[model samples]
Target: MADFRTVPFLPTAFHDDATLDLDGQAALAATVAAAGVDGVNVLGLTTGEVTSLRVEEIGDVVAATRRGAAGLPVGVGLGPPGAGTLALARAAAAAGADLLVAPVPAGSDPLAPLGEVAELGLPLWLHHHPAVTGARRSGDELAALATEIGAAVVVVEEAPPGDLLAVLAGGASAGVGGLAALFLPEEVEAGAVGTVAGCAVPERLVEVVARYRAEDAGAAWDAYLELLPWLRLEVGSPGLRVRKEAWRQRGVLSSGRVREGAPLAAASKLAITRRLRQVGADVSAPYPGS
Candidate 1:
């Protein structure tokens, strides 16, 4: 479980016209994975903007994600077992995905989707997020699902503390999300094996985790603090564009276009330059998005 490091969902990069940038996706993966994340989510309905992509485009994302992750474990998020969902699972499996992140489907049997995709034979990850689905599961329920799917990792987001304890007590390897995960040091101290974070700049996430483990709490807090300005951009809304802009600032992505989400204000993009500079990232290089 200690080996489970911080895993950020790779934000989908796009052309200004909103078409997927396959090369940018790969570059995002390779750069962040190299920065020290143990794993990455390359096919999230939110982070990857899968909701706005064509079914065939998802396969492209799977391939690009695989290329970027190299040999590291790759996680793919699936909603439910439908024709579209199954297609995604097949693509992710073919791409050699090591983990499947799932949420309990609404208006259907909670675990039925996992059972339907059981043939995929991938390790499961329970992403307990109620914000997206408006339904939350107990830790016991999550543990049972993990047992059913033979899951190796569990993620708790927007859930109660006791539920997390329940899952941990069930002998599940638990990862932290929500605000707790925002501060890696606190989450690590509270028994999180890993984190579910955005992949705008993984080196900062890595630094915080490394410092905390090295018993340098001050440095860890300082590192986490420096990232606060950027992270705050996503507080009240989906800041996918903001994150992409940061990647642009880091010289990794070409554009920060979103399919349907809120566009990042130009003022915020300028502020990102200062944020990137605080982390010592060379922001001089310009990307097309910049």
Candidate 2:
């Protein structure tokens, strides 16, 4: 099973015309791999825009991420909710995914779908994000599901500090999704295996994990604090447009254009760029289109 302790769900980059920019996506993956993340997750809420992508697109993204990861373990978030989940799982596996991530299927019996996904023979990373999936499972329920499906990891989204601590205390190798980097030290101290942020500045996030693992609590806290403003901005935004823009400012992506949306205001872009620079992100280049 792939170690998901410090996985970063990558943001999918797009050209100004809204087509998937595969090269940009590859560069983003390669950047994270170079930064020393434990693994990479694609096609997730902030990264893949899973619900908006077609089945074939999902496969393409997975394949592209695999290529860019350069042998780092790659996990694919199963795209969208549908009867086609099994097919999607197969596509992801075929495209070289080392792990499959998905929410418990919505139904009278979520376990049945969970079983179906487990049958695909890849390690599972069960996602519990009530805000997105509209389903909440107790910690005991999650542990039981892990046991049943043999999940390698569990992603708890929007988890408060206490809830995250509780999950770790239960001995589940859990990761937090969304803007909770401040909790990284506490979570690591409480036994969190990793964190999953869709931040554009992956190197900083990676440093946060590395410092903590190196037992440099002060350094880790400082690194996480440096990322707090960006994380707060991300959590408050609706989608990954800001993140893509941030990457564009860093020259990791060709452009920040999200599919079917106006570009962020020039002032907002400038502000984000300045904030990123203040936090020591490598934003030496000018923002695209500035």
Candidate closest to the true structure, highest lDDT: 2
Cα-based lDDT at residue 29, candidate 2 = 91
Instruction: Please give, for residues 174-202, the per-residue lDDT of candidate 1 as tens digits.
Output: 55554324555545555666777774667
Q: How big is the positional error of residue 286 in model 1, measured in Å on the Cα after superposition?
A: 6.6
Q: Tens-digit lDDT track for model 2 on 99-166? A: 89977555567777778889988988887767667677776777777777888677777556446546
Clashing pairs in 1: none
TM-scores of all candidate predictions against the true structure = 0.87, 0.90
Q: Estimate the lDDT of model 1.
A: 0.69
